[model samples]
Target: MPYTPVNVSLTLTNQQYVALRTVNGTVVLPPGSSGRPDAGGLKGIIVVRQAGNSYLAFERNCPYRPFDACALVSVDRSGLFLRDSCCNSQFNLQGQVIGGPSPFPLRQYSTSLQGSQLNILN
Candidate 1:
């Protein structure tokens, strides 16, 4: 089956917004980087690798529990992993709950790439 597409707008600083283009393919954006705090709420980042290629976008929120704050996924030299300082939940790059009480993965959104731009949707 084909994937459904969604549209989302993110408010980011000039620097953070500029960095979005650096990501070539599937990438995870951590808080204080691509994501920024807005009046509406915390906005997450969407990183697209290539046009017409695989695309991934997700919310910074954790799907486990409401009280369990600090659910943000980060990727570095060690790779992608979900870190929740409150509950100490750690997930793999695929958003699988490797450890902790999370029964489901992180909230993921549909993504599409157009030229050098990426569109993230619900």
Candidate 2:
């Protein structure tokens, strides 16, 4: 099956996501931000805190399950795993498949931080 793709360009202000700088943040699409399609960034994005000022963004959909609503992933307890509700698969904050029935890792997007806004694109 083929999945439809949309061009995504989302910007989250720094002050709005200050907590994300130290903690993991996960928002589902279709209802995130302004509740717009692009608000949560495509299927959604998981903003992870890294060393220094670095941050990472990844697609919320599990790669193995593709585009079903059941494929939507979330940040699990311990704030280090992204788990897919459908299959209970687990992925690391970096989109790496840690422990799951899935053979592939989660999809990742590109993120660039400006002075006050964090750009999540591609």
Best by lDDT: 2
| lDDT tens digits by residue: candidate 1, 1-122 | 11223354443233545544443433444443333332111334435343334555656565656334455444434434545565666766445678877677666666665554555666
What is every candidate's alpha-carbon RMSD to the true fold? 6.8, 3.4
Q: In model 2, which residue pairs have backbone atoms overlapping below 3 Å?
A: none
Instruction: State TM-scores per candidate.
Output: 0.56, 0.75
Summarize candidate 2's per-residue lDDT along 1-122 as a digit string, tens digits. 22334344444543545556554554434424455545554456677767656777776777775767687778886666789879888988778888878898866657776764666666
TM for candidate 2 is 0.75
Q: In model 1, which regions exceed 4 Å deviation?
A: 1-6, 9-43, 46-52
RMSD of 1: 6.8
